[model samples]
Target chain A: MTLLPGRIATVFGGRRWRSLAPLAVLIVLCILIAIANPNFIELRNLVRLANSAAVPLTLAMGLTFIILMGSIDLSVEGTLSVSAMVVVLLAANDSNGNDYGWWAVLAAIASGTIMGLISGLVQTTLRIPSFMATLGMWFIGLGLSVYMLGGSAIRLNDASIRDLALHRFLGLPLAVWVAIGAFLLAAVIQYYTRLGRHILAIGGDEDVTKLSGVNVTRVRITAFALAGFFFGISGVLAAAQLGQSHAVIGDGRLFAAVTAVVVGGTALTGGEGGVVNTLIGVLIVTVLANGMILLGISPYVQQTVQGLMIIAAVALSLDRVRLRIVK
Target chain B: MNETFSIRRIFEGKWTQGAIPLILLVGLLLIIEIAAPGFMTGETLALLFANTAVLFILATGVTFAILLGGIDLSIQAVASLASVMLAQLLPSLGFAAFPVAILSGLVFGILSGIVHVKLRVPSFVATLATGGVVTGLALWVSNGRAITIEEGGREKTAWINATIAGLPMVVLISAVIGIASFLALRYTRFGRQAIAVGAGEPAAWAAGINVDRTKIIAFAASGMLAAIAGVVLAARLSSGSPVLANQLLLPAIAAVIVGGTAITGGLGGVARTAVGALIISIVRIGMTFVGVNIFLENMVFGAVLIAAVAITIDRSKIAVIK
Candidate 1:
């Protein structure tokens, strides 16, 4: 007999209907979690959950486009760390004699953009695999971050910026607001932009996209650059929330972001998911973590669960017909 | 077109790939000796070998997977797990702990292989996920703390630090493994199958090669070797932690690529990886002598890695770089 998941897959086999699977999973998770702990559905806990999901939401938004292009970016942590360090050092911080304020935020995003652009160049111009180029870029970003920090954590003295994390608007923090804004912007781009279409096309079939007269190189680079831009925003948000930044502020984020993107129904092989799916994915991951804590499960087991979730999700969503050999 | 053809020929030339690294190794040693007068002494050489032993072993293990045109990102995590296993088991199992620890790595490697082969997940992603699980297991088993080998267990590991004919026992062990790997890759049916599969999977399959078995075995060997490196590391450090081999991943990968083995696969060997590992060690030591800041070293490695992959990657083999 077909398993429950298989039966669901058969029923919702339409291309458009596939996106509903993650949504269904998210809803079921919330229900199950609410049953486990009656307090889980409370407004305060959810607001906190939304607040926690801000950075990951931002991270996964950018990653969605990249993975949609069938290219992986392992440089999220590096990009995030570099941008975070940039914002901290350039803003009104204890480590440096600078108070560029909002300009610091602009500069942080620009730094992330430039790093992303470099990764794109390395991937397209140099013809290195996206993963390897980004992996190296991750190190470069980390080293750049460490070099900028000069071996110390820099506290953000700018209350205006730190307030982004602390202050609430409509019961949701400004960080979550910023994340929501990013999400909306990403959704618009995914649906309305020509670049978005190109990304999906490339992920679907690069050769076909190229043969159809699309500038595959430019599209790929732009996708990476756009992802980098998001990473920059998330970096600033992360630092603002923490009130301090270090070289490792981006550590642990890459895995979480990747896991969320994959679990959100965006196949690593690309072309099947988008930012909307990632939003659901971000909530699922955030809610799952919160539920685990509420159920008194050991924190360490969370990582194992995330890893297994990635394997299972990828396996379920995998397009086995298109691949004869996997390497 | 003619110039491009010639360039490709030179790069694809097996001897050129191996020769470049050897030249770089010699040139680097010469530069270091000139800069720091006594850096080339036999004592320093032995120290260099000793220092490079673990990295070499780790790199060599990963070479098997790379040779198959896949990668094992879990090596470092597996290595860390193995170290933790060895340290914890040594207290009770003594010498038997080494094998048990190694066996754990083998099992994990097989799991990675199964995930990649059976599930059709990409090697890197499969290994990444497995690495995460292994890291969690390592943390859980060690209780997220360092485990120091007690006096009784210390004696079991002491021989790792011992010298045999002026070479550290660790270095000797790595060399033997390296040589064995070279032989296995050169003379054995498994080695030839690995090469065939890596060269072209469809072609190998058409030629009746068991491509799946080769890939799995390659990953398994990679895992086992990584575990062996972990055991040696625990012996030398007298302790184990979940993060013991954390920093070695990039260096090990760098060693494999820099030794002139093409990341695209089927062009390099275990011997080339040995040269590559030594090259990495020398470059790191050379950076120390040049007084490059420790933090900036990673940046240099990143730059060097990009340059190496750019030079060594076989563009002709891959129609689409992604």
Candidate 2:
């Protein structure tokens, strides 16, 4: 009996070989794809992968907070899109000659943060489920973005703002550096802060957290606000990279970010997983996407494979004993 | 005497919950009728019924998944795949392909269920993952092209589109499915088990319910019904495009939630959801008829959904918002 218990402890301690399964698969895929095309190992490809991973990584880090609280935020895509559009509309050297400079970026971030706050308030004060509340934000954001942009893609020509994506730092783009910094900040807050512990407690057991005087509502609202900040940053980065911004930029980020969070060994049921896991998750997803493109796989097939991989990752990481019903 | 009085009160409370969506539906219709006199015309009404048919069907199917406190986000992707398959195989397999297409959807949905239950993943993630796979499959099968039925197939398409006794065939089908689902939820053991599981998983488990299996079955049923909806939609449109059903996701979920179903699981039924779908369809159609700016309309719709959920969700039961 002691031996069985010991084995279980070892497995749960994150020291066992099984904990590395997702990492192993990721490494193997990278190796196999690199072998298939030696160019995949080139510095340019690696840099490209890092750059591409930047936005999703930031978004995933934001989602990690909400997921850790055993809730979800589906509004990231809409918020990101709206922010991106705002960045382009305000700063882009368009035919209208509107050049608000760096202020545009500030405005974009503020919009995203405000949207997040509203969603958090609705969920916490109004007692709406996070899923429904965030979804409502999604529609509102999408509609508002479209209304603001008027179905036109705006080109960003502001050199200072665009430098974030185009400039290289430590042999990788500045965007990647920003993503790394964001990741570190998130990790710190998640592990070291009182709010972080409270979030985990909430996810683990809401009543228990409330009983412990955790101020559950405030913590959740803060998490969402932080999530919105990350989304705003991601939107700016996205616009910088593409040199243009449109309302549709947010279309696919939600799935990609959620996928990364899941791949990073974060439990969808929440109260577990962290920024480090999300970093790995982001790398895995970005690598998979990059590998598929490098291997010349059709975009359609890439989507299918990505979908399959998401399912497989969740299946491998999910803890069945804890959940009574999954919805 | 007290027992009888309490029973009557219980019945009345249930009716009140059921009445909200009905009232909203009538209210919207009345507003639309006043705003646009032509909105209630036979042709306009027929078109609205036809347009809502697919939504109603999909909503009904999703109601089952929602009933078990799980959501099937894969319905849109499944519908997309089913639509593509039906259209692509029509010439070779003719009408026989419809069942095959729907069956594929059911299989995919069951796969999602198995993964959710057996792997112990949350239904949200499980369905989300499967939804991605289904979307990928749809894209792959369609080769990124819309598959249109052959030119001469109009006769069959029209036949399928034709109304029975002045009711659109799609609406009639939706009605039949809704009635069947209503009965299953109200009368069957499976339905009771689902409600029990949703109400409190631990309690249901203690009561000897196979909670996982019930939830899985509910998802499977949802998938099958979504496929049926997809087939109907494909027949109506006479084409299958991989991207066509993508927009359906929000509306279907919105309809389910607005219908008084709890997002946190338990305490909703098919009848309530059907009423919810009707309300949604009318609101959307009515808004269009009134010529509300498309963008503002979306915002309003989303706001309404959130407001409805805020009003309808039972706060006492859910101790924490998350």
Candidate 3:
């Protein structure tokens, strides 16, 4: 009887090959939701869900790097808010005369990178824990967004940018294409780039990586910067979809990203998951959210459900034996 | 280095680590007094204390959670829920509504404790999830609007506003709680066990402490205090809304860390959080007095929060951030 338990552990725990668990969970959830509400399976609704997932997926893809490093960034919503405001004000808009064209997107992404760079610098130089440093950064970003917003939302008037939502490619919104492009780029970076592998190595064993002559400080900073760039892209995309830049542009998206990252089975303790898992996690979340709405659930209840999923995901992925302390 | 003659030697010694925030407090008072002379009058101080009293209580509670190498983000959410419940029950329950609100807080705290200890969920994530559920429940109870005390029910909550011997009742109540908590922390087994757990759970476990029970108690205390803060906040504002206390979370956490308590747990007291709360109030109102733009407050607050943690955290104790 004891051997049965030991054999089961060997199959699941020792193999280190449970990479597809989150995807399996997504498929099961989709089928269950479809049975509960047939409208969930409709092609039109699925397309809409894809469109909605694009923003969160982008945010999650950025967040994946940080989580893979065994740290967290609570500054997502704040970074999103600031970036969206900047893009709206800089683009061909009513609030400002500066229409820098595509450069506006680059500027916004650059701004996010700067914000992220500050967060990373703070983390490495001051040795402040990522949780506190990122939290403080979140506040700064939020404050800057509110300051720049000045009580009025600027409407994006450019056809090229606005067409991101109106434009469709392969039966999916242009936003989805952008998000998919982001995921592909992130995957390439994760697999092909030295910085990408370093992040996973640091998460897996920082001391060992450091002893191996890796520039841990520079790698950490670049990882955070990359994540920030993605956040900037996510925010700009959200603005494009909404056609307006408001202070609350990223008000409720932080949890969705964190939820997706964690739910994808990426260990909070660092090193076990990758961007591919995050893709499945984001899909699961997006589908669950859309399915709930179709079933006539209230938004308040939906928030609670999402919260529960976050906790459940964390609990399931927790390696209790490996955990020394939880803070 | 002149051992005894140098000012840095005397002022920045290890013995004075806990006193750093207090020293900074004095420096800030001087600045505020010089820059905003009319802002720190006796009446203004009382009002400031009144405004900060609830947060002071909440921070004091969170100090316990932080001491255990964990955090409780649900403080504001529990308080918000308690605020709504207090408003709902004020007419039928009268002043008795206070204990009920606190009880609800304790229940929520225990709920988070159960999740953290029993389910092995980390404290921050566990509390955050509970906070969402609490927020949703508060929204349902309030119907997405602020609930006010009834026509004549204001008289019942008036005690929260009343002054006793030139001190605001709110401040006085918080002081009483603060003093009691300080004594508990200084002299009680419960308090010491919590610190041990925070400093090193493995060591505490080896030393025969029930680490799990201590964590539960610590979380419950945080929840209870958060509830009390919410009830008092509703009384002060004359209304309770679902989102009323949400903004207090970061400030409360900041206050605890600013008091020289380590975010990684251990090495600070509950009383320091009360002093930390006072410092926060001065900085906030003082910034307003100095003609700073309202939009920049959050940025300044964020900077100050980071600076405070940087100053207070003992890097020697932490080998790696993760």
**Clash number for each model:** 0, 2, 0
Off by over 4 Å in 2: A1-19, A93-97, B1-15, B38-43, B153-155
**Highest TM-score model number:** 1
Worst 10 residues of 1 chain B by lDDT: B1-10
Instruction: Supply DockQ values for each candidate.
Output: 0.67, 0.57, 0.57
Clashing pairs in 2: A327-B70, A327-B124
* Candidate 2: tens digits of C-alpha lDDT, residues B231-320: 888888899888778778778888887788876568788877877877888877667666876766557767877887776676766656
**Local lDDT at A309 for model 2:** 71
Choose the strongest candidate by lDDT: 1
Q: lDDT, candidate 3, residue A318?
A: 64
Instruction: Give the alpha-carbon lDDT of every model.
Output: 0.89, 0.81, 0.85
TM-scores across all candidates?
Answer: 0.96, 0.91, 0.93
Q: Tens-digit lDDT track for model 3 on A175-218?
A: 99999999999999999999989999999989999999999999
lDDT of 1 by residue, A1-327 (tens): 134443555577745666677888899999998998999989989998999999999999999999999899989998999999989988999976999999999999999999999999999998999988987898889888998788678899988899899999999999999999999999989999999999999998999999999999999999999999999999999999999998779866887898899988998888888898899888888999999999998776766788788888777777765887787
For candidate 3, what is the lDDT? 0.85
Best model number under DockQ: 1
Measured with C-alpha atoms, the lDDT of residue A205 in candidate 2 is 86
